[model samples]
Target: MTEQTTGRLKVRLVDGLLILIMAVLAGCGLIYEYLLSHYAGRVLGAVEHAIFATIGIMIVAMGFGAFAARKIKDAFSGFAWLELYICFIGASSILFIAAAIGFTFHLPQLISDTFNLPADVLPRGGWVEQLHQIARYLPYVSAACLGFFIGIEIPLIARVREALYQKHLTHNAGTVYGADYIGAGIGAALWIGWMMSLDINQAAVITASTNLLIGFLILLLFWQKIRWRLLLTACQLLMLAFVIVLSAYGQNWMNSFTDMLYRDQVVLQQQTQYQQIVLTERNLQLNNNPTQTSVLQLYLNGRLQFSSMDERIYHEMLIHPVMASAPKHDSVLLIGGGDGLALREIFKWPVHSVDMVELDPMMISLFKQPRQFLPIRLAKQVIELNANSLSDERLNLMYADAFNQVDQLVAQGRIYDVIVVDLPDPNHPDLNKLYTNHFYTRLQQLLNADGVLVVQSTSPYHAQDAFIAIGKTIADANFSAVEQYHQNVPSFGQWGWSVAVKQGLPVSERLKHSLAAQTMPVIKTQWLTWPIVLASFNFPQGFYKNYVNIKVNRLGSQQLFNYHDQAWRKQQGMVNLNSNQQISP
Candidate 1:
């Protein structure tokens, strides 16, 4: 080959490698951003807020990183070292955050064990609490560090491309940026398509391993251009070994850390596409003997769904009131009760068919056909707990988001005589949509003219405004009548529900007449009685008097979620209740 031709080919090869490196690094960087955000949401209570905050912090840090990359005098060495740092930080970030949060969570127990102090008697709301609060936010710090390194990548790649060509190419920035954007798009697609459902540690290891491989390629292909070839290669090998170990055992370590966050024994835990499902058991002891009745509690994304001991109270109240009040019980629609506990109650009525729209099919599978991963005894208990309602011949299960599924039912003109919304509290914006007046309005259209619709409103005492707003939203959906009721369930203190009818006598009056006429006797319930049902409709005077500023949860407004989050934070002491700047629950 001629001298000029050889020189041009060399430049082309170097340019291609640099662009490829930029693309791969971009993909890795995007995955790291998602990883940190997802972990933050899992640890923090507010999933949406945590995700947005983490991404925002990372993006701002990236801008600062891009600006700061001008400080690197040796582009080749700087880019290589930056990849190493990114690899180490990305691989270890989640584990480090988990360890910090778990240590802080278990600190009280550690102190009590060391000092022989009673658990409740230990000091609180001091340095320990401060440590807990600080630990909760470690994800943001990790995010900033990772994002800073990721930000330097494109600038270094551009510099290397220019140096390889022996001239500053006008298209350098545009070309490198195009590759980076395309790689990031691919990363996003991978995350949504596959990585989202993988074990989080596994995802981290895979991303880090990709970074390590890219760094190795750079060190090998540009040995003379980059300094510290031997050290970088050694570091690459070491990081590869570390990633392998993490792949083998990191999820176990993560589970141990996660177990520290819970008070009871975490018997079963799974990360599904929708949310984290944790099943915990509290073995009660009376007179130093283990009692036969152990409490099995189900939690979705760290929020308690139900405790087996008092779930009857919650479920009976959620189901029986609306069932009795409805003029007919031949058809029913249930939204978001994948556990089948509510379905078990629905079966008590004389419903000919039940159509359930649950967002998570894994939840349905877990309850319907308990997986072998669950302990055999516990699996049997789960099936028995729900009476295998998921597998019943009357059930027509639709594994889809209720927000969209409700619309389809409306389009099909499929109306239900009774509809039960057994969804979770509106902790995330996606869930907040379900609480909007638009959602309730669509649901109103899906209900028979005289049918009853009931929702599992949040706690009456803990989140009174949120509960009231839910009732108001349903009322605003053009229901003919609406009534709010509460029952003190031990698991969830003072839980509430809202019942509405499209056009008929109100649910409470219908329920009262049903009780008086002896027509509701067919419903055999363990925890529900006539007086309890009737009295649930009664609230302490003035409970409904202070809602002057409450607004109906409209589309995109998320008022119900705001109320619930504010109230919950106040209850958890996360909000400063005594300050003038404090938001009212």
Candidate 2:
């Protein structure tokens, strides 16, 4: 009975040690992903190289470490030392990757981005090779140190159990593996949930510091000897210094590198499980500051989500027609349209209450900032809520679930009198889904009686097939439809919109009738004249032939995406993404 009790105690201790090692290893994977995305845009570049490189390096390194694990049979109790070494290696790997790419491509672009210059002026694209070199070298170093310690620690843990409490090696290994699983899960959860909320440099420091603390704690348990306590304290102090110094100086290094790559100011930054969100601020006008104006703007990923100079087109198109079509425009509900442009237009009407439910909080924070175009008045109207919230009796739902076409609201049973599908073209699968027959049918359930739905399809000419598909989908959903074009935005070529309603009426009638009077508080300031209303319907012969007969059974959503992608490939200095083919404003 005494022997069995002692043996069980040994197994528990071994398990604890193994858990610590696994936590450190799992952190490596999390930190690696976070850093890479921050350093490079997730969508662009050769991510395949980094991913394949990480896996290849880790597996190969793990194999070598596994062999080392078997060889260090007698010296296995030194798992504490292995933990300290692996933590250092994992933590330092960040700087290794950063330094490699930092000066090469990223920093130069950051500086250049501060000013707008002619094309062929920016650095050419062969920076991937330098990144490949970094990826090739850094992962091997991390894997060698991480894999070696991880492999060696398991056997060391088993040996310690066998010696300290006389547990068998097999029992020790099994017990330790269980702890390993639990610790890895915890590490993964923590990184995704909280660590990812930080910038890459911050995430790296936090993750590394965590490992160091845990490593010291494990040492305290295993190293009962007085002499080893000094070593543990010294190691902890070293890690503390590492985190503090890196925290202080690391950001400057990172931003410098990023500036070079993007040729823009790397402003607001965060790492998520999937990607890095960077907000860049470019001083469009340096010599003179525009008073009562926003000189700086924010960009997400690489796309220009918002600008201070003007967003009249984005908002006017999204809101004006929806308001023009809706019953009374009393209470409003906006979902996922966080740029505040849609809300800006909504504020133009005598809206009693407005609720905007944006999914990403980070984006909202950026929205609250004062831009020349994004006034506090626009941001104030929002009753900010998440998309999954319920609509009250007051909500005249205004839906804009069209980012990359992955409209979560489409599936969620709800209807609005005014639905504005201001989404990107059918580029990715998610964006394409919003243009599908299934999505329109889902949207049908949410419309109020006699409600009007405005969908921003791609160009009426360039992406004519995609534009046609949107109309067909709305028709398939059993809604009477009318299509229009307005080129208010120069960024996107001529933009398009499809208005689908429960009742068939010439869109021009509803649009004309819905104009706000001069007496209205919001409308007193701006122009919503009947001239703009007349111009919206004056579609050319080309747009008419484009949407001739697009049907559900024959859905080629790719036509729009392909056209846009090809145009993008053409790369004649600019492409319009914000407004459709024919925009009206």
Q: Which stretches of candidate 2 lie over 4 Å from their true place?
A: 1-85, 94-102, 106-168, 171-173, 217-240, 251-280, 284-294, 325-328, 350-353, 362-415, 422-439, 456-476, 482-498, 506-585
Quote model 2's TM-score.
0.66
Q: How well is each residue in 1-585 modelled by candidate 1, as lDDT tens digits?
A: 899999899879877877877877888888898998988887767677889999999999999999999999998898888888888898888988888888887777788899999866764558877787788899999999988888888888888888888797999889999999989988999998899888788899899988888888778777898888888888888888888899899999988888887778999888887777888888875777733656888888777788888899988898988988887889999998899999999998888999999888788888888856577767877888899899899999998989999999999999899999988888788889999999999999998888899998988888889999999999999999999998988766788999999997998898778777887756788878889889989999899896777899999998888998888677767432111011110
Q: Number of clashes in model 1? A: 0
Residue ranges of candidate 1 with Cα displaced over 4 Å:
285-291, 574-585
**Best by the TM-score measure:** 1
Question: Could you tally the backbone clashes for each prediction?
Answer: 0, 38
What C-alpha lDDT values do all the predictions have?
0.85, 0.54
TM-score of each: 0.95, 0.66
Model 2 per-residue lDDT at 232: 64
